[model samples]
Target: MADFDYDLFVIGGGSGGVRAARTAAATGARVALAEESRMGGTCVIRGCVPKKLMVFASDYADLAEDAKAYGWDAEIGTFDWPRFRGKLHAELDRLEKVYRSMLEKSDVEVFDSRARLADAHSVELADGVRKTAKHILIATGGHPFRPDMPCADLGLVSNDLFLMEELPKNVLIIGGGYIACEFACILNGLGVDVTLYHRGGQILRGFDEEARGLVAEMIADSGVSIHTGTNIVEMKLADEVDVETGTISNSDAALGAPAKNDSTSLGENPKSETRQKAGKRIWVKSTTGREGTFDHVIFATGRRPSTADMGLEDVGVELGRSGEIVVDEYSQSTVPSIYAIGDVTSRLELTPVAIREGMAFVETVFKGNRTPVDHELVPSAVFTRPELGTIGLTEEEASERGEIEVYCTSFRPMRQAFIDKPARTLLKLIVDRETRVILGCHIVADEAGEMIQLVGIAVKAGMTKEQFDRTCAVHPTISEEIVTMREPVRAG
Candidate 1:
C-alpha cells in the first residue's frame, strides 16, 4: 500500500467514478479520482440535472393553463432565462461542492484535471504528474456527437445549449432522439418557434410504439413543428444585405448555394460577434428539399463515449467499435488491473445504472466480494413535454419473445378533462402469457417518470399480471389506470 500512491485510481469525476472512489475509500482503500471538468460529470453538469431543471421551467406554461382550468385565474408571463439560468448554475455549483465534500470526508484524493492511462496500473494527469495505483477505474462518461456534414460546425450540440446567453427567437432541432424532442418541447414551451427534423418516421425509436406515439402527438400538439423523414442537407450563414440596417440578403440564395467554409463559422469562435450573427439566421436546406432560415440549428443526433486520446489503446485496453471500453459483467476490462463503468462502457447510459456499476466495482475490488452489475429491467424516463417512463420490454420486444398480452389506456386525464385540454395520458402493461408475469410497464403522461419507478419495483420483483390485478386501485388519479385495467386490450 505504501509503494503505490493509491489503492484505486478512478478517472472521470462522473457518477460512476465518484461512487467508486467514495465507496472504495470507505473500505480503507487509498482512492484517488481525477476529473477534467466538473465533479458531477454529465448528469450533474450538462446532461440530466440541468436538463430536468429546464424541463420544469418549460412546463410552467402548461401548468398556468391547468391552473386557469381549475378556476384559479392564472396566466403565464415570459420565461426569464437569465434569472433561471443563474439559479440553475448556483444549484449545480452547490451540488458539485457536495460531491467534493463527500469525497473529502471519505478521504478520497481528487485531481481537477484530465487523466489518462500511463499503463495498466498507472494514471497520468494533465499536469505532467503520473501516479501509480494497484487498480485503475475509468468512468469518463460521454459527449454529444454531431454528424459530419457540410457546414455542420454551424449547428450546436447539447452541451452548447446550457451556455447560451439567451434562447433564440426560432430554432431548428435536428434528430428524433429524446434529447431533440425534449429540447423542442422546452423551447416551444418557453415561447420559441421550434421545428424538429428527423430522418425517421417517428420520434423515440426504441421505446414502446404506443407510448412513443402518444408522446409524439403530445409534443406536436404543444406547438413544435415536427418534420419526419427529413434531414439537413446543407447549412450556411445568411448573407448580409446591409450591415448598418442588420438586414439579411437573398436568404433563398444562401440556402440554395453549397455551404462555403468561411471565417464566420463556429469553428473560428462561436462567441464572436460574427459567429453570433451567423447563428441568428442560418440558411438551411433539408433532404426533403425545403429551404428556410432559423435563428439557431441544434443537433441532438447522438453522443459518443469520452474515451478518445485517453491512452487506453496505447495501454492495450480493448475498446469496442464505438470506442466504448468493453467490460465483463463484473466491470473488469481485458486488462485485469483496469476496469470501467458508466456511459464510457455504454452498458446503460442512466446515472443510476452508472452508480450501481460503481458500487459493484468497489465491492468486487475493495471488499473481496464478487459483485456483477445487473443491466436488466431498469426503469428510465424521458423528460419530454409529457414524459415517457418505461421499464422492461417494449410491446414489440415482448411479443417476439413469447405469447403476450398488452393492456393500455389513453385518454384525457381528469385535470385536462376539466379544462377540455387536448392533453392525454397513457398507462400500459405488457404481460407474458406463459408465466403470467408483467413483462413491461410503460407510462406516457405528466410525472410518468415517477410512476414508472414504482412500477419498475413490481416488474423487478417478478410480479405477475394477476398480482397487479389484485392490488387496489387509487381512484381519481392517472396511475389508478395502471391497476384498474381488467381486460387485455390486445392478446396474441
Candidate 2:
C-alpha cells in the first residue's frame, strides 16, 4: 500500500462529508476533512437547521388566532425581528460548535480551507497545501443558482435568507420551487407583504399537480400574492430606473444594499455593490409586463452542484452538464480513488439522502463491503403551510407506466373545520391495479411531512391496497383517511 497522509480526505464539511469523516474515523481510518467556511456546512449553517427554525418562528403567527378560535383570549403583538434574529444566530453558532466538537471526538484531522483535487490521490487546499490520501470524498453540496441578467445580482439566493439583519417588509420571491414557496409562507407569516412570481404555470413543479395546486390556494389564503408564469426580466436600483417616478424613498436611496453573493463587475456598474444589497428596495419589471418595487427580490430558481473550479475535470473525473460529479451506485467517481456524495453528486439533494450516501461510501471503501446508496422510494416534504409530503411516484408518473388506481380525498380537517379555517387536507394513494401493490402515498395537510415518513415505510415494503385497508384507522386523525378510503376514486 502506498503511504498517504489520510486514509480518506473529505472535501466539504456538509452533512454527508461530516458524517462520512466521523464514521470513517470511528473505524480507525486516518480521515481528514476540509471546510472552506463554517464547520456545519449548508444544512447546519444555512439550509435545513436555520430554515426549519424560521419555519417554527413563522408558525407562531397563527398561534394567537388559533387560540382565540378555541376560545382562549389572546392577541399577537408585533414581532421583534432583531431579538429573534440575534437568538437565531446564537443557536446556529451553537450547532456549528456541536458539529466541530463531534468531528474532534472522532479523531479526524480538520482543515479550515477549501480543498480540491490536485490529482486522483492528492488534494489541494486553498493555501496551496497539498495532502495525499488513499481515497478522496467530495461532499461540497449544491448552491442556489440565479438567472443570468444584468442586475440578477440584486436577488437573494436561499443561503442569504439566513444571514439577513432584518426581514423585508415587502419582498418579491422569484421561482416556483419549494425554497420560494416556503419563504413566501415564512415571510407572509412574519407579517411581510409577500409577492411570489414563477415562470412556470404552477408552484412546486415535479410534485403531484393536485396537491401543489391546493398548496398554492392555501399559500394565497395566507396573504401571499402568487403569480404563476411570471419572471423578473428587468431590475435595477430605484435611482437608476427613475428616482422621481420610482418608489425609492430619499432615506431608502441613501441606504445601500448589503454586499452578498459573488462580486460582480463593479467597473461595469459603479453602484452595483450598493445596488444589490439585501436591504435596498428594487424596481423590477416582470415578464408579464407588470412593474413593481419591493424591499427584496429572491431567486429560488434552482440549485446546481457546487463543483465549480474544483479541478474534478482536470484530474479526469467526469462531471455532468450541471457540474454534478457523475458517481456510480457506490458513489465512486471516474477516478477510482475519488468518490462523491450529497448535492455535489446531484443524485438526491435531501440532507438525509446525503447522509445515507456517506454511510454507503464508508461501507464500500473502508469496511470492504461494497454498498450502493439506495435512491428509490424516498420520502420528501415541502414545509409550506399545509405541508406536502410524498413518497414514490406521482399520480402522473405511475399511470403512464402501467394500470393504476388513484384514491384521493380532500377535506377540511376537524380542527380546522371547527375553527372555521378554510385550510384543507389531501391524502392520496396510487396503487398498481395488477397486483394491488401501493405504488405511492401523498399527503397534503398539517404535519403532512410527518405523515409521509411512516407511509414511506409501507410503500417501500410494497404493501398492497388490501393491506392498507386491513390496517385499523387511527381515530379522529386526518391520516386515518388514507386507510379508510376503500374504493379507488378513479382508475385507468
lDDT top scorer: 2
What's the TM-score of each model vs. the native?
A: 0.93, 0.94
Q: Give each model's whole-structure lDDT.
A: 0.86, 0.86
lDDT of 2 by residue, 255-300 (tens): 3444333312112233433544533467788998998887778888
| Model 2: CA > 4 A from native | 239-279
lDDT of 1 by residue, 1-492 (tens): 448988999998888899989999998999899988788988988889989999888878777777876889888788888898899889989999999999999999989988889898899889899999999999999877667675566677777777676778989999999899999988898899999999999999999899999999999988899999999887776643342355444554343432222212112235323456554467788998988777778888887888888999999899999899999999999999999999999889999999999999988988989999999999999999799999999999998988999999999988778788898999999999889999999999999999999999999999998898899988889999888998999986
Clash counts for all predictions: 0, 2
Worst 10 residues of 2 by lDDT: 263-272
**Superposition error at 155 for model 2 (Å):** 1.7
lDDT measured at residue 324 in model 2 versus the true structure, 0 to 100? 88
